[model samples]
Target: MKKLITIPLLFFIVFPARAQSSSLEKRVSINISNQPLELALKMLEKEAEVHFSYNPRVLELDKNINYKAESRTLDHILNEILGPSISYKVHGTHIILQKAPKRDFYISGYVRDGESGQEIKNVSIYEPQTLASALTNTHGFYKIKLPVQQKDIDLKFSKKDYDLLIQPINNRSDQKLSVELQKTIKPKVLTAEVSAIKTPQVKLDTTPKIEERLSSNSKPQPVPVPEMEVKEKKVNIDLSEELAFIDTTYQKGKDHFLNWLMTTKQNLHFRNIQDSLYKPIQVSFLPFLGTNLRLGPVVTNDISVNIIAGYTGSVRKLEVGGVANFIRKDMTGVQAAGTLNLTGRSFAGVQAAGAANINLGTSSGIMAAGATNISVKDSKGLQAAGSLNVALSEIRGTQIAPFNYATRLNGLQIGVFNIAYDRTRNSLPIGFFSYVHKNGYRRLEFNASELNNTEISFKTGVPKFYNIFNTSFSYGRPNKPLAGVGYGLGTSWKYGERLGSNLDILSSVYFQEGEFSYLDQHYRASLGFEYKVFDRLAVFVAPTLNFYVGYDESLDFSSYKLLLSERTSRWLGENARTYTWLGYKFGLRLCNKS
Candidate 1:
């Protein structure tokens, strides 16, 4: 009983003492003058009642030390003696000292306009290679922290309406920098006859090192302006600019929601952010739930898989989505989706979708869709869709769909209805109805042919190729009561001011009382002379060599004489008769211009 009571007393006494010594907050007094660090620490250990533990090489115990503390906390004494090169941790009654880790460097500066010397806010300051960026505040002040790097950093500053500035920085320590930007100036307007604008001279600064200005105890000092050089850039500006489709209009309903969801940081900073960080792979359930976190749309990925839908900055290799893939910028490789694929800028490779593919910028690729494909700018490759294909600007390749539309076409279009708003001399649009708006041939004619007494026809397309639709009535034959409708293609050439020639091939189906009957096909080569009688009216007469193919021999031919006739079995089967004859036609053409 006496031994147990004594042991308990000893434990209580020792536990309190150890707890007091363990805490660096404990007050201690020490005075060591011009003593070795090894000896000084030994003296401090006794005063603080704590053991000093460290690697001798790191602590450099042989170094001389001079420190004094009067009733100060152990923490204060240790901080003064250790300096910043070494750090210490407490464990029980012991202090373990080790070398400190490398510190992060800071860069802070101001941005101003070159001429006005006024502060400019919202200017983007970034390191292109590292993608480390910061923006200037309202006061045009900015700050960024950077890790230790081996080489110099290339920093860039950019803003709209201002010239881009690039600064090389040596980030060995903290620094302060100031930059000036010149505003972009518009050239003087010239006469309408001038097709291009001359190049302008620009002032570009020389790359200079931004010196370190930060000190351990004081703030950064003022920075000096770097030197620059004046350089001339040869530029030819065309007044007749190409059209581009960028949705700047306000949106509502579903469009608004989808755009909001797919909108990314890159879209807002495309002009300033010239580089994108590469990501080898990305897997996402949705735009917000991706492996890239909130920066999903600011990185280019090699392979991207989305379960439902995904949004990204760019695609370098392949991207597939269960529903849709929305790209904020360019796509260079294959991109496929179950429902839709969309790009904010250009695309260069193949793109396939179950429903539709839409690109707001130029497309130089092959695009296939189940429903439709739309390139709002220039398209350079093939596009095939089930329903419609549309290129609002220019198309340099073929388009095959049920309907096709382009502002200018340099290739071919195969669809039921094709329309080109601009002039195309070498393009061919093969369909039931084809229309070209500029310098295209379109005319409505009323004429009497040898076979049908009353006929009305409409022609629309380019002069090189056009579509024709005509319907005729044989009114005097009451007993037969025949009506004919025809579809054909024709080519026209203007010989002079008032003379033109046309070659047409038409196949008309004649029926009585809307019942199927026989087919009448004819090829006519004629030389027409048209005299403009009014602003939108012209009278033309043409003498033609007509080769007629008639399926029904029961039709009377007493009114007209044939130069040549042959009876044989052809596409319409037995009793098919072919006749060659000379015919004459006179018509009034109603058109937009003569």
Candidate 2:
């Protein structure tokens, strides 16, 4: 990234506009920007069903604010957007989202002969919970994910070649077994001429016991008969063997080659985007990437806003803020913000930010970006500003800078562009801007950013679109006092995949105010990879080969210097990001370029 790294004007914030008075509203516009675009769009459908289920009517408000129409507030918008399909819990402004489906109980096993230990095929297993029934495969194995609770179970198994078998479990823990068949025995009839077959006979006599005879006049006592009990023929069990089966709820994670050394915050800060980006994707006649703070692959897309917001704590006095987006396709995007140390401590100073990006680009596409310093008050305690800039891009296509300056060259744009500056200043101030672009060939751009102080940088390149490599050259102008050119050459390579790689190498020569002066020189090489081995997400990695050379002419000696060039990248992996729903959160921020 050149010195003037901040993007000029961020893609404006667009949202749905509403009229305060209305009854029986079938629909309304939603203005969700700087929030999660992917997730928000999905949440809209669930929220819009106000006619009945989920109570959308309750989410909708019938009131006015500052003489405005009855409309939804940010809080209500969030509430409605969070519908019932997804289980979500909210604390303060942060939301916890979770999805719950009927739990699955998996049953898997093999079948074999009760005595021969031979694998059995076409064996059936059934569970009523899921109406799941399966036959053993060729390997005599069967598996199922169902809902089978603990209870005595009944299952019937029948094979054309074998006899029907009914297995009943008196207890849930009873192990299942197989059936064995034996050959039926045949009996021969006996001959009638068998010798000395004797027939025995028994005679019955009616008599009374000695005690009963004397008491014959009294009532006779009832006789006690033996008890009758019948039992099922129990299935044979090999008690020596221990049957093992365990029900569990563990899913197999997909295979992903992740380089743990690659963390998100550390990688997304790579190659700063120069301030001269153009917008080819837009809604209005104006040249814009998106309407307001919303951006997307097409005119209408969603967005996501996931960040922690807080004012300077009394103890820490920390002012922190960040905005995120799903600019390309999925919600996977980038972010940038600032923090002012308000702790009234030794380290208490306003911290400005210039970041590259925050997204894991696999869901949507590849991206490149940069953020400019927004700190109006510097470490030196200056109030006004040195300069402000912001330059962020998704993939390598159109840039969204409307205020930056550019020269319409064939492929090498030469002129001053824009710098992203922090607008939350101590007092109000005004400035001027310029911009130009042509959508042919490899792109070229230049930018000049700031207030009072100055910074300059330029980029010329063939966007490595459908092909593998992007060829290019870059130069960062010395800030003010040393206003000269610093030059470098490089290219990038990528294989589009969940797991992909990228490499770039470039060397630069810096010049001071004098044309023949050499202030610095260096070489930078980088390696990166992108992988999407998970659901609705992708991971990114960026590491670099860095070396720098510094010289001081005042000493009349040329010295070789070696310093490491820090490289950065991002993994903002979000999908279905809700930048703005067309019928809902879709409006434009009006800016007059004339």
Local accuracy of candidate 1 as per-residue lDDT tens digits, 1-594: 999899999998898667756578888878799999999989988987789889988987878998878889887888888888888877778788899877667789999999999999877787644456677888989897666763778778888788889888865688899999999787888766856778998988875445533324466689999999889988988644331222334123324544576534433344444456577888889876786544556678889899998888788899999999988778989999999999877899999999999987799989999999999879999999999999989999999999999899888889999998875677888888998887668999998867677889999987778899988898747433277788888888876666666777676667655446555566666556676677578888887777766665565444466465544556555566666778778889887553
State which candidate has the highest lDDT.
Answer: 1
lDDT against the true structure, per candidate, is 0.79, 0.31
Each model's TM-score? Answer: 0.56, 0.18
> How many clashes in candidate 2?
72
Model 2 misplacement above 4 A = 1-86, 89-96, 128-131, 148-156, 161-594
lDDT of 2 by residue, 1-594 (tens): 543443322212111112111112324455444445344434444444321123333332222212111355433453355445444443322334455333444545676665577777655554322224456677777664444363545444434445445455343332434444222234678867778868888878777679978867767689999998988889998744342221111111100111122222111211111111222222211112212111111122122221432111011122223432222212212222332111111222233333432221111222222332221111211111122222221111122322221122111111133322221111111112222223211212222212002222222332221111222222332321233233443333435533444343545444444555434543445454445444223344445444434442321111212222222222133211111111101111111111
Which is the leading candidate under TM-score? Answer: 1
Question: What TM-score quantifies how close candidate 2 is to the native fold?
Answer: 0.18
